[model samples]
Target: MKMIGLVAIVASLINVSIPFQSRAETVLSARDLFDACTRADMDWISFCNGFIQASNDHAVRLGMACTPAGTTRTHLVEIFEYSAARLLVSQSELGDAAGLEVASAIIGAAFPCN
Candidate 1:
């Protein structure tokens, strides 16, 4: 069950494109998500928010996180932005980590299940 949830999240994040003669798989990176969350573009900001919400939902459903009731989207975004920034700064390698992986980690850390 946990594996299924993880697979679903991963599938949602994978971007598969088949151009005329080429195939490409583009996955969102932690750095990209961080930039999106901090950017001025509304579209990027919306995308970032959606991604964080989905990640948090998945974590909670999987018993990985226990977010407090009444947590708003804005709060989730703040948590992600702050945590992701610290992680990216301390571990350069995390910049390239899958966005879902980073988001899941942040959510879990901020709201761990007892």
Candidate 2:
């Protein structure tokens, strides 16, 4: 019946890998991400959040951190910029690896599981 068809569609969508190009997949520098963040670039913020969400999702699965209820995403951008600035002192590219670094640092400071 209709329920069976709907269940099949949901099951099929579960493992589908949508096109999500993380910073590592691109060549933009960390400086740029930070710069965009300073200016509050909507596009950059959107992309940055998307990137962080993926990292956070994985970290949650590993029980690394627990996001406080009612926490706003604004913190994600703050953490991203903070981490990027710290890292950019040496390296340049703020690739997806930086996203992971950001997530780890933020988890400890902002959402410690303890």
Best-fitting candidate, scored by TM-score? 1
Candidate achieving the largest lDDT: 1
Report the lDDT tens digits of candidate 1 across residue range 12-78: 4333322212311477777888999999889988988899999899889878789999999889999
Off by over 4 Å in 2: 1-40, 90-98
lDDT of 2 by residue, 1-100 (tens): 1323322322333234232254335544335545666666678778777666665666576676687776566776676566556555543332323434
Candidate RMSDs in order: 7.7, 13.8
Superposed model 1: Cα runs more than 4 Å off: 1-24
Q: How accurate is candidate 1 locally (lDDT)?
A: 0.72
Question: Which lDDT values do the candidates have, in the order given?
Answer: 0.72, 0.51
Residue pairs in candidate 2 whose N, alpha carbon or C atoms collide under 3 angstroms: 24-96, 30-94
Q: What TM-score does prediction 1 earn?
A: 0.76
Cα lDDT for residue 109, candidate 2: 48
